[model samples]
Target: MSYQDPAIHRYGQVIGLTIAAFVAADLLWLPFSNITVDSSNGVAVIIAGLIAGGYWLAGAVCSRMARRSRLSKVWGAIAAAFENIAIFLLAFIPMSVASCLFMYLASSTARPRLDAYLVDADKALGFDWPSALAYANSFPMAAAVLVFCYAALTWQIPIVVLWHACVNGRRRLLEFCAVLFASSVLTAITMAAVPVDGPYLYFKPAASLYDHFTNAGLSHATTVEALRSGPFIFLISKTVGITCFPSFHTTLGIVITYALRRTPFFFPVAIVNALMIVSTVPEGGHYLVDVIAGGLVAVAAIVGVRRLADHGRRIRTALLPSE
Candidate 1:
């Protein structure tokens, strides 16, 4: 019997529930809160719908091709893998935008600041972020290299998704997407409980030492300004990064590394991801505790996703009624 991939449907169910919760929360909060709906958010929703439609269309085409030829199983599976990639990408875009909006909304609800506590926790652990930043900045070349790796997060997701889809197969690709979904959800939880602006803003003066390393237009200044204005809109132009406490960058590094494990790309990917995680401190202006939290979140997400997949399979088997 062909092994059933539960990750596919499991992904859909989880995503649907997540989006529903966010929409409900947004509606409930809109009346009493200072937050206002922006047209950009609507644009984001429409774009997400388009992407999802394309994903389904691709899957339909792939399925038709697969069933039409007896000797094309390999190619058919490959096409199906691309379909899987589409589903994942479609899921990722909306999930990311939703999570960002969720985090910002949560931040707006909280009146007190949490950055000082997080900074203190870092200091208590003997992780001096300032000294670390200074040391990193001392080496311009190294700092530049790390910054490049840090920026890789933007393109890494699609590239890794494509790589897994084309090379591994549907099951593995689904597994990766499942873990990502879990991580993104966990990120919202952690950020809401303790919203922070990261080390750059918390340590603005000290961070300015490395101002030369930062991109010209982007800096802590812009983030601070946007954040002070109000809650982030889904597709708001130049919306600031509101997540802190746990570094999503660190979480991403762990997830990617975990996804690539047991493959020929493991060692190389490991090194790159390791750099990416470490670079989070300086490049991302994240506190040490934040990075630790992100790593833990990644671990939990992987374990949780696996158990979910296993439970889904067991339930499916039980319902199969006598072989």
Candidate 2:
């Protein structure tokens, strides 16, 4: 509902979180000279700060307005929640960059060798697969996946966040966060385990999107190499490594689709996202096998999150009893 001093509490939280995130980032960067020295890293920090600050400011303004207008508590909560979600999403940029650095460092020990094995397996699989299902062979199927992937990154999260804010419902917000967290964890693991140079770096004569990968600054191997070279080099490399085996791009799309399934307009959005995921094979330089694996991971993450939420609800119900 509407709080009397909304701006006071909310703005304080915003400022505190911003300062903490900055301090934490700086502290984390201290040991890594490359990351600390990299200009891109600095830019990333600034961008993250600005984004967080903007959302915080927006939320403060919205809260003040809501208080004055005596807006419904549900609407106010939705606004606040969205405000936080935007900040969180924006914060992901720096976090993701940091994660890549961490990924490289972790892989340096025994992961490189392990990755070599994965690469070999990917090569053995080959990219070519005959059309088994007629639907699978359609061009429209590929186009749909491409659109879905693009929208998920560009649109879905924002839409979901807004919906959560408008609905002011904890369940949807928690679901959204769970999906994102699960996807991120799964992606990090997959990238670590199956770090391929993608079709471009690993395969020759670059067919389809593989050519784009070859020409792009960051294929999968480039990311690993960037890690080896240090954060500065990695930052400068510009090209995100193309780990094709389990396309997080596709996986995230699936996660978003599932997360928004209960919301209005979700079905159409989900369909678009599903298509975009399918398109990853051609548009994202992934193999059919990679898409399948990514899909399965998304499914597992969704199921796990649902079960976790259910368990949490049960616990809450038991504790609260009937109100």
Candidate 3:
């Protein structure tokens, strides 16, 4: 196999291993906790599996055609792109489910919430979250834009799929996905260690911001509450962000923006994600500290993945010559 082939395969294996770890963690926790996931999430997982399977099948067909055709590179690229899309969907969606499960499980801990500490850190940094939120509420149009931009965290998946399919890339795409997995693992670890009630719940911002919260359908407070000290039914379809120590929205905004670097879309993504980070305070129910820590986490994950990829490539090169 080509050196390039091993890189892509390694990316897939790493992601698969992480997801399996997440699954194992959830299984270990579920039986002991009062939390129960509804059937909706299982059904959603099934649907996602079907979609990813279809992409993989298409990629296989493309690969077969590439082997027999004159335009081998083009066909091979298409195949790789399809497989990358499938890998992304499989990695992101289910990992999300399992991680969400772990988040709720973490919330059940008796450890004190970190809202005060986080808010105090924000204050120490001279960041006024309440005032900032009020200012944002004044400009409804701007707030709307922020909301859309924040939602870009989810919408960017399709953009990634398109980018990979259209662009000639294997290494870049793998690095992007690997960074996401790394960031997620770090996010999960930190979340499990430090559970927060989030600034929105702690400060209880204005009715306007509350409306923004309600409309977003995140309801992280409710989920956290249910898991902490209430009798509530949790479902996978109803997953919301409960981890606030490292603002995942912020992490995603940074990571996704970085992934699009060198493309025409990079600057636009950077601008949107900049706004997305701003929205995290109001829409994401996060503290300023969370955003700062999230940026740090993003940097760490990016550097870590790049170094790991480089090291892996070096080992492979030392073992065998390129075809």
Candidate 4:
């Protein structure tokens, strides 16, 4: 028997509804911000949309034509995987673009910088940001490892999706995906309200401090300032990571590890992801408080998604009652 998880559809709806709201928001806010989304981004989204649609169509056709033959079975499995990929791409790609827009729009509000309080909180916790950066920069191999792990988040997502699609781990895949959206929303809930300058810019760490350590956070300062100040202009194709309070990188570290658990990728990936959080503190220029909050947000998002799925099941049972 073929088993399908109900939560897959439910979580898909979470993304669908979220993207709809985001699009509606863009319509409402773009006029006020005087922002122009780069044409290249639209072109990319169109191409991605076509590819997603093609994958879905191929999946449908393959499923219908799949026969008992060995080749057909192999093609069927591949098509099924493609179908899962299509599902993720359809929801996630839009979510990604929309969320980026949301970040900029949130920044336009020009909230007061929270770097002082964040740094103060770090001091209160007896953590020294400069000392940590110096320590990280002192080791070349370890710094390289941190750089690799920090960069791993971008690639790790698709790999997890592919793993689950191949293994028919649909529920796990959707749950992880839901956790992603949930964490993003949870972290960005106070974006405009709790704007932060981040530790690297706030501390103004000396040039010599990060020679060996690649501080990825320094790269986005230009774009962040562009949005925060007047004349908010951004090229969508060139959008960078902007959130700091609840670092999305930190959130992904936890959720990615959670998704890959019990698999061969778990130990190595988890070790890297563990180090990824450490990397975020120095490389991403996040305060110790940001890391702590991000960890809490990730755990909350994961647990919250499970509860939402359960609540959805209960609602469905009450309505259908026939199943």
Poorest stretch of ten by lDDT in candidate 1: 215-224
What would the TM-score be for candidate 2 when compared with the true structure?
0.67
**Candidate 2 lDDT over residue span 66-115, tens digit each:** 77775757546755775766655664555555555544443443334333
Report lDDT (Cα) of residue 59, candidate 1: 66
What digit string (tens of lDDT, one per residue) describes model 4 on residues 11-125? 7667676677777877788888846677788888999899999989988887776764568877788778878878778878888888888888776666578788888888999
Q: What is the lDDT of candidate 3?
A: 0.79
* Best-fitting candidate, scored by lDDT: 4
Better of 2 and 3 by lDDT: 3
lDDT of each: 0.72, 0.56, 0.79, 0.81
Candidate 1 lDDT over residue span 1-323, tens digit each:
12356655665566666666665766676566555657876786677778767866876777787788775677576666657767676766666666666665666664676889988898899999888888888888898888877877777666667777776456777678778878878888888788676776667655366764664213544654555576544455445665666888889988987887787777776787788888888778788999999999999989987887778888888888896
lDDT of 1: 0.72
Candidate 4 Cα misplacement greater than 4 A, ranges: 1-4, 68-70, 314-323
Q: Which stretches of candidate 2 lie over 4 Å from their true place?
A: 1-43, 70-82, 90-94, 104-152, 206-241, 321-323
Total clashing pairs for each candidate: 0, 12, 0, 0
Residue 39 lDDT in candidate 2:
69
Q: In candidate 4, which residue pairs clash?
A: none
Tally clashes: model 3: 0
Top-down TM-score ranking: 4, 3, 1, 2
